[model samples]
Target: MIEVIDEFYSAALAQETIRGMIENARGGYRNGGLPVYGYQNVRSTDGNGNQKTRYEINEAEARIVRLIFELYAKGNGLKNILMHLNDHGHRARSGGLWNKATIASIVRNEAYIGWTIFNKKDTKIYGIQFKPRTEWVIIKNTHPPIVAEQLFNRVQALIEERHPTRTAARTTASTYLLSGLMTCDRCGSSYGVTGYGRGKKYAYYNCLTYSKKGKQVCPGHSIRADELDAMVIAKVRERLFSEFNIRQLLNDLNVATRTVKDGRCEQVKDLKRRLADKEARLLRQYEAIESGKIDLSLIGDRLRALKAEQNALREELANFERETMLAPPVITRAIIERYRQEMEQVFIGENVQEQRAFLKNFIEKVVVGESETRIVYYAGGIRIPSGIFPATSEHPRP
Candidate 1:
């Protein structure tokens, strides 16, 4: 404990020292030996003959960078840009042909707009960790910009539009869709599929926390996968096609739109306005410092605090947008019938992964206990007996 505390304090001190240096460095480039592609270093000697490196635009490479941003902003995909550059005999900084990933990196770089960001990543126990935007150190107009600020902002907007936040894991061919959906009733831990018996033909869902951490954490909660899956499918099919449930869902959506959605839209608008205000304030501070109306030292703490607030606002704004975009669909009778038919076909004829995905759409969670299993559907839940099949010698629990 003492050693860990000492190490933590040391790290904190190091981070603070670096932050101070960056705030005071006053638009000087501080590369940790990584070469930036489009810029050449400009060396300067201090009064004491100590040398420092700064950045200046390399026109030839800067032209290529400009072309990349232009192509991307004009609706060219990364692959198209890559092939265009490579086909024209253009090469990367490493003297290799351009690739899709390289084009993506160039497009995402803020250095093209004369902005330098620090503390974007840190070394962690597992690997390099990308730190949140709140923790980043940003220096604006640090050097000559290849792209206009308006163009850069537009590019960033396009990137965000293309990639939205995900609430669930991406589906893969081999992944069992329902693997992480079940939980242990006792300990509220995820249940994993375990295979047992000769040749491991039988699959059961068991509490992973209990298996790995012993009974101190959770008791054993196990159930055969086939029986549970069948029960779940039956329950979903019964509830989904019912006219009463469909009407209730539509009524709930109407209520949400009337009461919740208006308030949420107003909140989102307020956040956006505040974000714009903060950005404008940052720009004013920069202008003040450049015009000698305010000292750089005086504004350091304020700038960091403003940036942190802006980052937080951006996160909240993203959440609100996600909630708005992924709002519950307004289900009409026709839509419900079509959905029911598709679901039935998928459950009967599709693969296990597809069936699991179908289940996830409506079922929020499944909790397994000793004698009963509770399934919480998106609209509601139902409790059923654990063992749906008669116990036999071949299917005995461990």
Candidate 2:
């Protein structure tokens, strides 16, 4: 019975997703997330006052789009195009230099030629598994085209002829430990992952500007992922999970709880105001009944109800005040030891993705120089568990 119900729920969710996507596509509306780099989302109202997101060309970005298509058509590979863009100071929509995958995505995106394609991947499964092209919902000329259909098709042909199925380093993009977290110590441009393929997965997050824009912009610097991931993991386990650091974590937790407690204090204040208002109303009612202005037989139930509400408010207010007065929990030795063990397991565990996530949370930014890598800590920072800077630890590049 549970399995049957779960299957039904899965089917219903898939249907709803497809239906909503198709509806949005047919109506020429841009669905959520970031719009393609060449386009910006403009909100428009229909006759019935329904606000719809419409894709409008961002002229500056469109020029970059046209240049990319033209360059690709002129026999430039993804790396060459990426280098050209970075060398010329052209940044991605997210304020980063163009990687090979970014360039490939722009080339393959149907929106360039004004088509809205949906259902590219099956979302019903536990992991993202892409659906075949035949299973897609494609609407033509949904918005203005950045490039001609002829040019777009030519680029697609070139991509197929050159790369086949976009294998090599691109396929292993997710496996890199420090893909997005590291930045160059010299120029501050992000590090791009490369140097992996041909059955041997050699991982390195090299400086982007150095790779694409030449050494003039930023020096050629690269960090070995396996060694650095190990070192950083060790440092985080030793320092971040230490009793001193756990105390900072508890402080952050207390600060967040205090915010909630302050909100409760305001709630208690509001309850008191409400109780006072109820009492004033009761007094006015008593005076009226005593003066023979209102009949007791008629107003007696209302007076009783007002008194009941007043009592309820008083009880609620007292509970809230008591809660507000309670002190935040202290960081105990047991908590620190337990947290240390759990954190050690997280790093020691085989989940690279999980390790990266935790690293990004505690470590503010990792600045890799020619000689040493500097890690800035936000041990008391981040949302939920805010942090203070414990230390800016540096280690020689392995």
Tens-place lDDT digits, model 1, residues 297-325: 98899999999999999999999988866
Candidate 1 positional error at 94, Å = 1.6
Worst 10 residues of 2 by lDDT: 383-392
Candidate 2: tens digits of C-alpha lDDT, residues 118-165: 877788877756688899888897889999999999998877776635
Model 2: lDDT of residue 170? 50
Q: In candidate 1, how many Å is residue 254 off?
A: 64
Q: Please list the C-alpha lDDT of all candidates, in the order they appear.
A: 0.73, 0.75
Model 2: pairs clashing at backbone N, Cα or C within 3 Å: 380-386, 380-387, 380-388, 381-386, 381-387
